[model samples]
Target: MAIEDNPSREALEFEGQTTVIHDYAAKLVPGILQTEAYAREVLGSGARPKSDEERDRLLSTRLARAGILGDFHSPVMWSLLDEAVLRRPIGGPAVMCHQLRHIAALGEQRRVRLHVLPFEVGAHSLLDGIVSLMWFEDLPPIAYVEGLRTGRAPFCS
Candidate 1:
């Protein structure tokens, strides 16, 4: 079960209490941490700017506190983060370094997998916008494709 949030595609307004986005992230993080291969394939193995060693240490500590290590032990979970995401300095040099190091550590886990879709990969089906797919135990796969005006749901056969 992978719950991915694309800031560009999703308009997440901060309301009091737990927003749907945060709820989704919180729910999925545990599963993602358990699957080491999936974590590496998405968060790690991406290009980023330079940073210092202190930032790396901070990232490790944060990851551990966040219970990422426990998540790596799960057998059925993963998530994907674009290369552009890893490169983007959401915070600053230190923050970015910590984040990237966290990603790299998660990547090193055998059960986790991270994939970097290079900028050169160019446009694809998701170029127009963002979409998410959810797989349920007793139900068919559901996909949510959102646009500026509205969204649509398509079932996966």
Candidate 2:
């Protein structure tokens, strides 16, 4: 869940038009379904095993293909789950019960909003990790933070 964790103040008031930010939980869908089921079980053999309603319909068709890009809108502020990410159940238990029922059906969209920060909401202030903010149009707002490898862009000056 990252598009700079929701930082598109109307895509920074609209300018040229290009605001891409992604994190998708570090792109870890059980290590990409175990590397696409070991590359379709060695490239072939009709390797199949994606039930749970076809992995929640391929994660709701990749979240509606990122809401069809341009003018894409989501996170009208609220998806903050962290209680060990809803009790850490990744691709098990029916892929975490169909990924928590496909994140409760994409939080019954209306521009989604699904808060769940309870692990007792312990610790504080970004817990020494995860950050993203962007707003482009008139360009003047960007903050990205990620590590344990590298990534840190701080703009807005």
Candidate 3:
């Protein structure tokens, strides 16, 4: 997911409507897979720094996007992670530990498929950002591409 002053509205609406999600991340953990503490830390780490209320509100919105993953019936999430995401501790050791365990548990439960690209693999495309592809039952698929300062999730059919 793209963490910004305001999260991408298109991406949010699209995710809620999609049937399958293919996510690839090179830096940070994708939103749907983030734990509460991890998400809080990320949302609060903005350069402008939000007030407690603002952070809480944003956190709630971010987490709410994951609700679709709760149902066992559909919207399968396939996550491809670059090794750096696992190596970097975003919210200190405790929070990081919980985050890792959460991802692992999700994999064990077959909720989300986790694919980690090791550091040894070295230099590759999409190393500087995150991209997510979504498929819908009644709509055409689209891709969300997030860069250092830009996040575009326009729908295409």
Best by lDDT: 3
Residues 25-70 of candidate 1 have per-residue lDDT tens digits of 2112222232233322223323543244533432343234334234
Per-candidate local distance difference test: 0.38, 0.40, 0.82
lDDT of 2 at 144: 53
lDDT of 2 by residue, 1-157 (tens): 3434322222322212324332222222211112233222212222454555545433443334335322435223233445675575544566566666655665564333555556565676664544445455456666555332234465454
The better-scoring model by lDDT among 2 and 3 is 3
Q: What TM-score would you give candidate 1 relative to the actual structure?
A: 0.43
TM-score of each: 0.43, 0.25, 0.89
lDDT of each residue in 1-157, candidate 3, tens digit only: 3355546445667888888999999998887788999988887785676899987877787688766677787588999999999999999999999999999988998989999999999899989788999998988889888643346776475
Cα deviation of 77, candidate 3, in Å? 1.2
Error of 2 at 27 (Å): 1.8
